[model samples]
Target chain A: MNWMRTEMERPGQREQFQDALLRGDRPAVEEMIRQELADYPYWRDELLGELTEQYLEGAVPFSQLTVLAEAAAALAEHLPPVAVCGSLEGNPGDTGRNFIQMLFRAWGVPTLDLGADVPADHFLDAVSGQGIRFVIAAAFSADDAGAAMLLHQKAMERGIRDQFDLLICGAKLTEETGKKLQLACMDHRAAAVARWVVQTWKNR
Target chain B: MEKQMIFPANRFALVPDRDEVFAWLQCDAGPCRAAFEREWVPALQLLEETMTPVAVCAQRNANALTVFLTIGKETEKRVSALFQEERYILGSLLNTLCDEMLFQMDSKLANILQRELVSEHLYMAERLEPRVHLSPETLQADFGSLQSMVPFARVTTSGVLYPAKSMLYRIVLTGESRTVSALHDCARCDQADCLYRNRKHESLREKEKLPERELKESTKRRKRLVWREEIGIPVLLSSNASVDDNSEVSRFMDYFKLADPNDAAYGALSDRVHLLTC
Candidate 1:
């Protein structure tokens, strides 16, 4: 029913939108996204994807990053809640996990933001204690990887691994690491992860 | 707990340059720039009206120098009273600005040391090794000796060195040339939350002169500087090794005199002893 969604549905428009974001066309991106939001309030995944790409490319400043995240969170108000956590130790500056949370919120997915330096037990408590079904865990440093492994080990110890879906992301998180931990490795692309979350929720 | 000695305030003098402090405020002005600008004038006026600069004496031991410092008592009282009355955000801003001014005063003191004593390096263990270096208890224990140095500042019964905005630091004098050993290695330190480490990493990356694509690709695997644990000079003590429970107990006992349980002060002394030991 939304014209902007219909326009975005046109072939290559999504790519153009992504290109605009990549080129750092803030005004154009803001105007188009705001217009799109007026009718297709749930059209957050695509925008999140573009923003994520820009962030990964090192085009977004920290202040602008927060603004983008807040915008995404605003759109995500109608979605079911999820839980996301950054590394227990500080993430390397390159890690975009915080932005990924913004992308999650943009997809109308309510998120419990367990901030950086979270302990393993805290992550487990958020899952089993709060009855959260899906978790997005991110790590950026060697210490962060250790913390993530500890979280997984604790979850396994408590026999609650089967109770929730754990999705891992970050530069340090490889496919081998994901396999070792028995968790899905969400690709670095925020839009792809956002879409996956939407599809998974629909299937559920 | 070694006994502390406090020298008279006449032994040292600290004069803060308003311009240098303003320059530092501007340099550190990032996200807080607007707030800093809005508060700077009023804060400066308040400081001019209420503040008194005071320096505590220093002790020189061969190659080491220990200096204690604090902004005078009246200013601390005024600031605390203001903080209690003001909104949380504004109070925090004022507090930070005052701390910055005090830090500027400390910098001036360091400069004076360099000029008078021919010392080139000044080090605060807190700033250098935030996680593992000198603990507050050790500083407080050492501050006992220097407590009488500043008449206005007091060491709380719990061994907290007060005039909350205070600094205790050591100086390094290298004759003829100023060459400090590069001891901080970000990759080696367990303090992942340190902003200094993050800034160093960013600076190192900038110095690499790599193209964007190459920089991105190489950042993950780039070799990191590792800290060497060897000490070049015997003068600098290992900050990590300086403080222990046994020493803390000895110091606390010396400060409070907790020798006999049957003494009239036994109950209060026992409570303090328990708190210190625990």
Candidate 2:
């Protein structure tokens, strides 16, 4: 229980963990998290963190977002009072964006969805004088992906970037690009975003 | 070999109800109204051009009967292409048209099946719809009888029909006569508050214990659930919906529709609402 020794993390266990997460089997995730009390941090980071990385890289299929959102919903109580989310303007079929909002909704997280193809300024205005903790922007098109970065850039230029967490998401986002732009980038999936949000909240 | 009957390209097109389709799209008026006004006729025309509505009916072992109806894969693709192109209103209208078509097709087929069964002196005593009356095991075990006709559709391991728009039904035939439309499979459920029974949130909002006038919007009443049939999306409303409590003829979108009546997305809908029920 005191950060002792356990069997090494293996590809077999990793696959099983991912299958459980993607299937929204929280009990299995909880079981694996508590599999062995030994080296608790190692197990949590390796299993969950690595899974988030896989999700960010677009290794996970787009259709699995709901189950993945369900997996992340356990962290609901840890969520902020309210947040704003939307797909960048003019992107048709806001399925991914809706699913992500639904992810927040699953935990009864109060989200002001600006609807698909939102102008970045609407986001800025929604949080003004409001208790918003973060902004989750989804981009379904290559153009909207640029809009996400643009939103981050505008938030920074206005010196309002520090006001709330700005999470830009697209399949195109990468750790390399995020670091290069110095923007808080998110994976296309909300599950990982939720996890990142919780981690960021804890760190804050 | 199981004998199969496939109705291909029959002049059996059922024109969808315009108001119902508009209601499903949440676009009875306003910004979408103009779009819907401009596009519905053309959209219906396009749907008719693209959809290959088909029905398959088979008389199974003894007197068992089964029927599957679909507007075909290409019709679904056409609707998907519209959504993909971001013609949200038109695409949604056409999308709901497909469902209305399937629904009309189901009723028509059911009647046809009824007539056939009656002539053979067999009564359609009991009927089962896939998700409604049939259990997962029953759907999986029973789908084999109809699968060969639908090359693209199959019951999943968990028993959801692929190409979700496709409809499946099985009608039980018996020697004894029974009323054609009897209380259905819902009688079997034990859960008191099923969404299926309570989908009429508009009505329930009236029957809500506390009148809307007494409840302060900021008091934050416990959230209630409402569903729009065939809208292809979910609506999770914000709790700030205490103003303009026009529950009658209010679309699901009206609950959280922005306050400014001039807002592009939902402006006309909220403003045009009257006391009449649609």
Candidate 3:
């Protein structure tokens, strides 16, 4: 439990913010930001810098970006399907699943939540049995790429690899690896996913 | 079934309080305190000067220090063996440090940036956009004085506290690196039929200390030879060489297979090992 805390922002705060974001409570984020800003006047710039870092580094994608504006607008809405995975790189506390949920909501897709370290069989059962349209494999290292690869293999074995659009996103995914596997590798950018989904859907 | 074998002196329980333990070992009272103090300070100083490996450890878990100490069996055996007279003082001192409050340790946040979350930058870039407006100055001012803290506690698990019976203790250190590089080579090796051939760490030379000629012959023959327990596991070198099935080391590796070594199920492997290793 203690190790869990080291992996991310304080769990309580993170959870609250996540809840607010999911509820589409833009005002809450704005208000919380304002209060935090007031609490640490000196850290306002740094906090924003950190937030920007999160955004640019793809922790908070464009779809999730809407949460910022929506917070400003004071609207709260629920999001779509999500999946969290442990790091392939051995780094702890990645929140790509939550970010993806936010992005899927922006695309008007209802995302299911399947948490981290989930096995390949579980993923297979979920996708085929649960009618999952979008599959996002998130990892933080090259070793984690195996999880995504397993999914690819499973989908192909089940003859559904081409049926549903699949995307692999993470810090661990390499250009060569993605090209080798023919996976649609994206960083944390929701817009990139959005673009790909739109194009794939149109082509379909 | 067996009256869980207890050691002669509950050497582990001597210093119940973790903080007192750390003070004795790192500062004064430990069995190897003097030597460690003399060597450690200098090593730390040198490490700081070069900054080759990031000192990513945090104060959160005083236990992590002890856990790190036990990472290598040879290191543990050497330290544990020096447990008498002034050595006892040093050992006790070390034990004291092991008992200290992990949260009290200093967290090198810079090291976290450099080592622990090495690819955080890449994660940010892939998920978020490149340029964004930030009231950077205010945020810096906010967090400037707030010290970076580590949250994990390094408590000794049930299994790790037992006193040693054998001269050497078994230490299991696995990583994603080995499975990716070495296991792949193992799969490709001609000796795929060997039972213990599938799992090996990268770099046979590093694992196996053999001359070039023996190494070549070993590679060609694919003879899975077992080493005696005297030297620990019989290490086969050369990318991912097969382990002799009859070796004690192979037996030891087999005992741990309640969980798979490669792509363990549901990350449960890490959690189980954490509990067992402390």
Candidate 4:
């Protein structure tokens, strides 16, 4: 190899080459940045999260919002379907539910979402009556699980257990108790859960 | 096909025919479409309560639509009576009814939609409000837009939206393609560690490995690797490796590329090959 070519093969060369691809302003190299990031395993989550945070903060375009939403939905479909119920007041989980719903659509799973602040009876009624494959009971605070448990119990009582499957996920299912209940423990990484579920379900 | 609610703020309109539903949604006059959508709420209210499929139709040029619900003859009659002399309020009444009806839904049926792909978008609105009208002529000219609105998700016909969710994209060889499919449950997988494995594929030895504290946890794990019975028959759905199954899934996966012209994943299965599997 030529000495100069070998010299150009140093660690910094990749970054320099990437930088050289940009040629000038940092802002103009977004496409190059995207291409470079595409194959990076961690890039999808980081880019998605940044874009999501920006959109939620009202700093991103609606088109970008849709892209983020679609990616999230694709991820959400792989996991067990969860339904979160809570008052919108001071509860960010409800917002998370909306984001997940949009993401599920993007990922190609049709989601029937009943919005937040829903009455526990109504929630139970759906749990009792519909063949919900999974019931994702979400409560932002400690007190929320009471209602979720009641709904879960109601499903059992109504014989809804035979028809559908239920998976409770959220802030309320503490790690310690999650193990107790034998519920699938999921981290706040929504996309990760979604992807795992899809992969798991497919392999299953 | 049954209409399923996939996410929050999700709405489904059951018209006698999908074209008419799209046509009404596309009307230029905001109130005209609003009046129509508003009128359908009561009917939806009834259908949701009865927990059955519904078909709604409008009288020619009458701002009113007739709803024929199939929860049962008696329940439909009662619902019709509720609508006969009742004054309708758009949001409040519908919202309240939705709350009540959602409670009455058959959890099992709802669960089916949750577990299975149930709908496709026949039409999707790029923007909301002003009702966003696409007349019959427009739909015929570009019937494709209505395809997205199908109750099912992620189905494309010639890039046009269709209302079926029984398909998925699969990868063959190197490229990605779409296929009309029902995935086999992981319970059927030959691989023991297949993560998707649920109860249907559980092994007795694996069960014995759980610690005392983990017994309940083990029961909660989902089953894995079992393909739907229909998938095994090539006639019902083209086998993943079949020549006739040229769906978007085949095109997507391009199994041709995976062929390697030289067997790679299954050298043992190929007599001429020498790859080993332990």
Per-candidate interface C-alpha RMSD?
A: 13.7, 17.1, 23.7, 21.7
**What does the lDDT read for residue A71 in candidate 2?**
45
Docking class of 1: incorrect
Clashing pairs in 1: A76-A108, A88-A117, B1-B250, B1-B251, B4-B145, B5-B145
> Model 3, range A1-204, lDDT digits (tens) per residue?
011222233436654654454343545655655433222211322332344456566454232343332332221124334322222222222244444444443333445546544566666666677666666666543445665677678778888776555676544355666775566546645345544553454355
Per-prediction TM-score of chain B? 0.49, 0.62, 0.20, 0.18
Question: Which 10 consecutive positions of candidate 4 chain A have the poorest summed lDDT?
Answer: A1-10
Off by over 4 Å in 1: A1-43, A58-64, A86-100, A115-119, A129-131, A137-141, A144-147, A165-180, A186-204, B1-177, B181-278
| Model 4 stretches with alpha carbons more than 4 Å out | A1-66, A70-93, A162-165, A169-172, A200-204, B1-278
**Over the stretch B60-160, how does candidate 1's per-residue lDDT look in tens digits?**
44344446666555555554454333222233334445565565566666555545544433432212221223333444554556656665665432223
Q: Residue B169 of candidate 3: its Cα lDDT? A: 16
Q: How many clashing residue pairs are found in candidate 3?
A: 70
Chain A vs. native, model 1, TM-score: 0.62
| Steric clash pairs (candidate 2) | A88-A117, A89-A117, A90-A117
Off by over 4 Å in 3: A1-94, A188-191, A198-204, B1-278
Q: Which one wins on DockQ?
A: 1
B43-98, model 4: which lDDT tens digit per residue?
A: 55554564333222111111111111122223323432332222212222232233
Order of all candidates by DockQ, from best down to worst? Answer: 1, 2, 4, 3
The order of the candidates by lDDT, greatest first, is 2, 1, 3, 4
Model 4, A51: alpha-carbon shift in Å? 12
Q: Lowest summed lDDT over 10 consecutive residues: which window, candidate 4 chain B?
A: B123-132
